[model samples]
Target: MDYYDTIILEYHNTILDWVIADKTTPIENLSVLDKGISDHSVITLEKQKPVKRTIACRNLKGLDDRNFASDIKKEAKNIKQLDTGAMLGAFNSNLRAILDNHAHLRTRTVTHRPSAPRMNEQIKEAKQERRKAERTWRKSGLMVHRDIFKTCTFKVKKN
Candidate 1:
């Protein structure tokens, strides 16, 4: 893959941004963006890495609650204990064993997309606003647009 080391000349005319990736993961279209709002330019890159992950899912298509309860009852009858804690522990373990027997775990491979775990609806909308403001600021180069972009950036950082 061809990588572009383009720098944003408007921001101090120095390489203030970077996108580092491992040898296995090729970084494509690496460029520094001039948003005309922040002190440092934004670094953007497209890393084409097809991630395949196996996820274990329980199959409960034919599972019935009444059958599950009867199985639990049978398992409970076998557990002869005096201590309340030990009885509870045995109950939980037996419950898990019965569940596993009823609904076995099936592994399936799927492609995964990386995302920010902390990001929610509000943060996502704030980021969208920040990007829109950034585009407007870069296009018009006006103080008002820059101020709005800075406000949006601050909101995003605060979250």
Candidate 2:
């Protein structure tokens, strides 16, 4: 059996490369991933079991202090009216309502912002916009435009 597998890793014709893989090691499954680096080919390896987590939140949007307090008291009364044998039983009776009332309790939506923009992105965008406008002004070649070179310059200090 040949250990080396030659594969042409071409991406949008922009990248034309080859990857020689040593297939001696056991690989459950190999699939080309949709995401990858500029010139590198990506493959997915199925190994670990997927994990799911449940988070509790409160959806108290548009409720003032007075109304919020009243809503809470009403939910508590509803739970008490369940007449279940135990606390857990009562919770199970109105589980959906309970979860709904507490959905907005935690500020995960506001606090847990995923993949936020970096400082470099803002600086780059500003620089690009400035450069584009400068180009347009130069192409018109009508009115004398002031030098816009120093408007969007950012100096990065290395850590």
Candidate 3:
């Protein structure tokens, strides 16, 4: 009927079965009423449950392909070493759940945000400049920041 009606409909479309994602979030927190009714009057919240994501390895924090391969190997070995099928299945499912967190680390990365206007043109230009500087630094064997050397895929030439 009104703007509130459309908003409630949109929410209903995404959240089927009236399930709240966060368990700690109380329904009463949303006490704001429009006119005399609520914006979420149509939303029937059943229960809120928190989501927890587990990472594969905490010790290995590098982007090198070797690290990824090793981490995967370590995880696989751990899974293989499990005595029971149920233990293996549980570990395997947990591994699959955190698939998004796993990534192949690239050598080139933007260290800082562009201090200029955040539009497409400015962002592109800034990225280009940063990349160029990194390339030059790599070729010339000149380190930009000493601490950044600790990151993935960086090898230092012993002088």
In TM-score terms, which candidate is top? Answer: 1
**Model 3 spans > 4 angstroms off:** 1-6, 10-119, 145-159
Mark the regions of model 2 whose C-alpha exceeds 4 Å error after superposition: 1-16, 19-58, 73-146, 149-159
Give the Å shift of residue 36 in candidate 1. 39
TM-score of each: 0.39, 0.27, 0.21
Clashing pairs in 2: 57-102, 57-103, 57-104, 58-102, 58-103, 58-104, 58-105, 59-104
The number of residue pairs in model 1 that clash at the backbone is 0
Overall lDDT per candidate, in order of appearance: 0.81, 0.53, 0.45
* Pick by TM-score: 1 or 3, better one: 1
Report the lDDT of model 1 for residue 74. 93
The parts of candidate 1 lying over 4 Å away from their true place are: 1-48, 114-159
lDDT tens string, model 1, 1-159? 333444333435653454544345567687776787977777777878688999999978779989998998899899999999999999898888898989987899999765545778999999999999999999999999999999999999998
Arrange candidates by lDDT, highest first: which order?
A: 1, 2, 3
Pick the lDDT winner: 1
